[model samples]
Structure formats: structure tokens, C-alpha cells
Target: MNGAFSLLIPVYRGDDPAHFAKAFSSSVGEQTVKPAQVVLVQDGPVGDVLAAAIDHAVESSPVPVTRHRIEDNVGLARALDVGLTLCEHEIVARMDADDISLPERFARQLPVVEGGVDLVGTGMFEFLDDGGAIVARRVPRTGHDEISRYARFHDPFSHPTVMYRRSAVQRAGGYQPLGLMEDYWLFARMIDAGASVENIPDPLVMYRVGAGAYARRGGQAQWRSELELQRALRRIRFTSRWEYVRNVSVRGVYRFVPEGVRKIAYRRLIAKG
Candidate 1:
């Protein structure tokens, strides 16, 4: 594919400097199809080490890397919104600071985008923070109809593996300020606005997961975000009352359970790949 795309990554204070560097190296430097530009958003003031890491990555990048800084941590949704504006191309790919995108990620997704797919996402492998073996795979539905049907109960696309049209996203109102579920909410809007979407079942990215990753998925804050997402889905008529109840009863309960139980349920029930 000859179409150019920009890679958008948001770095926060909590992100590991080493992981960020490696993520950039893999997603941009080692990609089979390189991005035309890399837009790095400093969500807040990173420490000296992280700042140096960012500088090193930008200086060493094969493609032009643009850095945008936020005085305070405004979270991923807002940071990505800002980064999207700085993208010079119509096609934009999202990457996380700690995830490893396979070499052929762009080579695989870009062609789908060029074929008139407004948004494309792929499956991912979950690896531990110490860089151990791939533990599990999270695969989403690939067909558009299946994706829309699946979105009512679960996020059908892995957020970090998504490459989407800039115009389609903006027309769908860009990224809204939602904790935990911003990507899902934005995608719901995009689908409602009639953007063509698809997911490829290839594990294109290696997602980093710490020991505390499962625990992080629980807690009151996450539960609140889950409730907000369910309400939003209902408001958009994306889900009927029965679907909303099903989501709340099942997904909401998962958020309030013990960390160990949640991990088991996730691996067995949700991330069954």
C-alpha cells in the first residue's frame, strides 16, 4: 500500500521509559510499512529519564517524529484527541507506550484501510512485563456485521491495534472524555455514524501486562466507568434495555469481583483465544 499513515502514541508519567523506547522502535522503526510521521504526546511532565527516552526515540526515528506536551495529565482520550490534530495524514494508527506492534502490523492493516475500511483493528497477544512468553490472545470478530453485533456486550476491537480514518473519527465527534472506555465509546459513535469497520484475526501487537493488570481492571473507579459506558451504549440505542442489563449484570460484576477471580474469569471466559 502506498497510502501514508501517522502513528499516534501517548506517554504518561506512569509509563516505563524503556518500554516506551522499545515500543517506538518496534512500531515505527522496525515496521515493514513505516508511518510517514510519528506523533508522540507527552500527556504530562514525565521524569528526566522518560523525557530523555522520548528525545532519544525522536532523534533516532527513521520518520519525522513530532512531540506535543500537555502541562498536566489530561488522560488518554484528550491526549489522543490533541495528537490526532497534529497528524499530517488522513490515516492514523494508535499505539500504546508499552505495547509491541509486530513488524507487519501496518503492512497488514494499511491495505484494509486503503480498501475503504474506515477503521481496522487486529488481535493481540498478552505478554508479561518481564517479556516472558505470550500468555494469551485476545481476538475480536473480523466481519463488520459480527463486529457490530458483538459490540453490544463487549469491545469488539483491541484499541491499541486500531488504525482508522481521521475524518471518520472526527465526524463521529473524536475521542470523548471517558475513563477506561473512551475507545469503546468513540467506536460506538463511529459505527452509529456508519463508518465501515473490520478486524483482522492476526495478533499484530504484543500487549504488556503487569502482575497488577487484573487488579487494575477492578475497583470502584473502573466500576464507575463501566456503568458510564453501559449508559452511553443505551443512550445511543446501540443496546436495548435487555442488552444493557446483560452487560451490567455480567461485565459490571466482573469489575467488582476479587482480582484473582477476575483474572481467571477473564482468561477463561473473555480472552479465550
Candidate 2:
């Protein structure tokens, strides 16, 4: 609350530009602790509507909004890497283009970060498209030791709901190109490096989850990415041999399972809102 933070967001051509812009602008506007600046990174060529939406959000925002454009579609990890460098504040909060951050989100996260936590995230309420209905809630592990232990098998924090110290991220080598698991990859390394991490027990963001969300988490490509992440964790000694094997086995079951089963698993087993 006392110090300003930068909201870092990445926008790609695939997103619904108008929806994204509106959600982002409204969320930022509603925050109790307004950001000093909002850094919006355009990852690739966007259509006229999306481009115009970006411009409108920037022009209408109460706080200054800085826009960065990449020549081509560079994907989330690289786009975030670039966005991180553009952040004007040491404390940077990550927001997805489509997710809605609750009004009190920054108010709650700021104190945690300022209290010496290198990275702080919160639980999230997963909603349907347009946030018309709530589907699930994801409560991540809290505390440094608990988070480090949880990281051995799963992501201990929600990426979109995180506020991390810029220096801590840079010290951990920034974001890497790890496909859909990029956030998890970076968090794993940060934990390995002994960065202090914590999570607020309350839900601070409305995470939009469409019908196809779980399907996107499946597939051969995603499986390969998860495997790669597991290998990385093994190399970092974040996971022992048995833990790595168990992780891969459990993840594989979820990945190769039927769609209906996966949905049930995600809503019931995985997300504990």
C-alpha cells in the first residue's frame, strides 16, 4: 500500500482482445492499491479490434499504461521475460489477459511482499466464461517450507495470482521457454535457489476457465512438457528419484485419462476451492 507495484500482463493474438482489455482495465481500476504503471506486452500481430482495445485501455486508465509490442508471436514465457524487463517497479504483479483480479488483491499481496516474501500468490476462484458462474476454487500451499515441499510434485502457487520481487526472478534467471509449464519451471528453480515464497489463504482473483481448459492440459504435447519439467526438477534435486517417478506416473494418468474423468479430477481432486 505504501509502495507502488507494476502490473505485468502479456497479450497475444489468440486472446479475445476486447474481453481481455475490458477485464484487465476494470480489474486494475478497481484495485484498492493502484499500480504506478501497467505494462501490457503484445506478443504478436493482433487484429484491428484487439489493437484498438489495447489502445482504449491505455488511454482510459487512471494510471499510466505502457505498451510493448513484439515483432512476432513469441509465446508466453518469452513475452513475460520481455515484459518483466519493462516493469518500472521492483515489485511486479502478474496478471493474465483474461483473468479478473479482485479489488483487494494488491492490497493483500503488497503487505506480504513488503514483509520480505520474495514471491506471494493467493488462492483463486475459478469461474466460467464471462464469470457468470463459479466452477471451482484453487487453494495453493502456503509458507516457504510447505511450498518448497509441494513444488516437488505440483505447482505450489497460482501463476496469475502471484506478486514477485523482480530481483528474485532475475536471480533465478527469469522465465524460460517451457511451453505451458513455464511458470512451474521458474517457480521450481526459485524454490531451489531458496527464495522465500508464500501464499495468501484467501482467494484474490477470479480465474476464467472455459470448457476446453482441461482438454488443453491434456494431449501428447502437454505430457512431454510435464515430463521435461519433472526431469528439470530431478536435476535440481527438487525431487528425489522416487518422487519424480511418482509425479510422472500420477501426471501421466491425468494426461491420458478420458476427458470426462479429467474434468471431474480437476474440479474435485485438483482444485480445492
Candidate 3:
């Protein structure tokens, strides 16, 4: 395959490497236009099982696989910043360790990136853990204007389903170490920086949402991050002051509320969207 894009994935010890290997195997082995390389960032030390899985994936990959190892876990944002620098291609596609990229993902994304879009993301089919059952389908706003408008309240692009121009991201100062909202943070900044961003109106990835996903969203750290993100958006003029306050008031309550309530809210509001 003569694709000019590279797949960048960051893996940490907490991830199930066996499951990751399955995703990696499918992404590389089944892509309509294979990537120039697969840059896998090892964020920290992993167990023998995870290590073995990585080794097996590297050995079996159809495209060249490069591994960048960090001794300590520095989180996803920082890991991706490092991974972005190691990407050999100008266009980089982000993938989560356990998410499956559809076979036509690259083929569909390439033309858009090559056509001058700085960032391109697609809709996703969210599945329960192990991906046996369908949970929900997320069809993000497709046009730049629609995405920019929706981004005021919610993330307009799915992180794992995004393909971004490396230079555009670097010009936007790369990824910031924002807790749960790193991708949102970067995308907001990119929009502020005048980057051309769009979303394909197709589900290009299968996202794995585990049972504890909603529970993980509630907590003080995530709350603080959400507030910070809102403030940043307001500062960048992405959202008005009133919108910022409204977002913080509603999302803040959701963060501090009981996990059960948060889960229900997430299911009703977020998952159903």
C-alpha cells in the first residue's frame, strides 16, 4: 500500500494487550490502504502477557511496526505527543488500544486529508466490552460549521476515529495533558488556530466502552478538568460566558453525583446521542 499516513497508538499497562492485539491485527491486516507504518507507544512497563501480545503483533503485522517505550506512565496526552513526533508520515491516524478500525477507514480518510483538511474524524459504533453486542452509534457532525457549533457543548469528533495532519497539530502546540479531556482540549485549540476540521458521515471505528466507563467520568480530577476545559473554550471564544457557566453547572453536578446517577445520565444523554 502506498498510503501516506501512519497509525499512531499509545498503549499503557492498564490496557488489555490481548484485546489490543486483536484490534491492531485487524487494522493493519485488513486496511484497504495500509499505513506506511504503525507507531505504537508503550507508555510504561506492561505485564508479560501484554508484552507478548505486542511482540506477536509486531511480528505478524503486514505494515512496518515501530515501538517507542517510555519507562513510566505519563498518560495518553503526553504519550501521544511523543508518538506524534515519531510518526514518519505527515498524516497520522489515532487509534485506541482496544478499538477496532474498520477495513475502509484509511481509504475513506485519506482523500479528505490529502484534499487539505487538517483534521478528519468519523462516526463510531460503540460496543460493550469484548465487542459482542452493539451499544450505540455516534454520528458526529459532518461539516466544519456543524462540528464547530456542536463542539461548543460536546466533543465534535471521536478521538480514536480521527486522522489529523501532523503539522496542523504541531502548529496547535500538540496535545496537552488534560485529564479526561485531552482530545477535546486539542481539538478546541485546533479550531481556535483556524485548522480545517471535518467529520466523515460514516462509522469508521468500533469503540469499546466498558461497564466502568461512566463511573470513570465521575470524580474530582475529571470535574476539575471539565471546568478547565470550559474555561479554556470560553477564553478561546469557542463558547460564550453563559455557555461556559451553563456547561460547568450541569457537567459539574454530573461529576460529583453518585455513580449510579452519572451512569444513568450518561446512558440517557451521552450514549443515546
On TM-score, the leading prediction is: 1
- What would the TM-scores of all predictions be? 0.97, 0.96, 0.94
lDDT of 2 by residue, 147-266 (tens): 888888788888999999999999999999975799999998888887999999799998888868888889999899999889888997889999999999998889989888998887
RMSD of each: 1.1, 1.4, 1.9
How do the candidates rank by lDDT, highest first? 1, 2, 3
Please give, for residues 101-148, the per-residue lDDT of candidate 1 as tens digits. Answer: 999999999999999999999998999887467889987787999898
Per-residue alpha-carbon lDDT of model 3 for 25-119, expressed as tens digits? Answer: 76789888889899999998999999999999989888898899999999999999999999999999999899898999989999999888999
- The TM-score measured for candidate 1 stands at 0.97
Q: Which regions of candidate 3 deviate over 4 angstroms?
A: 257-264, 267-273
Clashing residue pairs in all predictions, respectively, total 0, 1, 0
Candidate 1 regions with alpha-carbon error over 4 angstroms:
none
Q: For model 1, which pairs clash?
A: none
Q: How accurate locally is residue 45 in candidate 1, as Cα lDDT from 0 to 100?
A: 88
| Better-scoring candidate (lDDT), 1 or 2 | 1
Give every collision pair in model 2: 137-273
Error of 1 at 227 (Å): 0.6
